[model samples]
Target: MAAAFLPPSLITVIWGFIGIVCPLFAKGPNKGIIQCCLMLTAACCWLFWLCCYMTQMNPLIGPNLSRHSILIIAKEWGNEITNTTTT
Candidate 1:
């Protein structure tokens, strides 16, 4: 069970490293854009890892919960807020 999460976690780490390295090599007017994209990607990767870590720790802290479900709920709530504010 624990082994299943390792691959995705490793992949996230790889992506984070890519995000960090990409901006350093970028040049010209697009450098800021590249850095912004990298920052956003890193932030998302960090959030994903945090959610997974929370889910893994749930067994010891509280009831077992699905990380996907939590993420879904958060997305829906964000969408709801955006929709309401746009009106």
Candidate 2:
């Protein structure tokens, strides 16, 4: 597991490198599937990032969130940014 203290962007760079290398080593259908999964993951990460930005800019979208819930969301935002990997 990666140290939580590391910047999320660093993790993203590592994962992106791994994703690229994986497809290079893979063959045929496996390569295609891995690439597709990576693309889907990248998309979801982007969507998560967008949601976090919107929520931060406009808390009125969900005013009932407790402090703990807000913290959870913040952690998720970091995770999302770290999830991207190029395949």
lDDT of each: 0.74, 0.62
**Residue 56 of model 1, lDDT score:** 80
User: Which ten residues in a row are the worst by lDDT in model 2?
Assistant: 1-10
- Model 2 Cα lDDT, one tens digit per residue, 1-87: 455435456655655665555556656757788777766676566557557755775587555887667667878788423334579
Considering summed lDDT, which 10 consecutive residues are worst modelled in model 1? 78-87
Off by over 4 Å in 1: 1-12, 57-87
lDDT of 1 by residue, 1-87 (tens): 989688677877787787887778878888899898887888787778777877786555665668666667778787422224334
lDDT of 1 at 2: 80
User: Model 2 compared with the native: what TM-score?
Assistant: 0.39
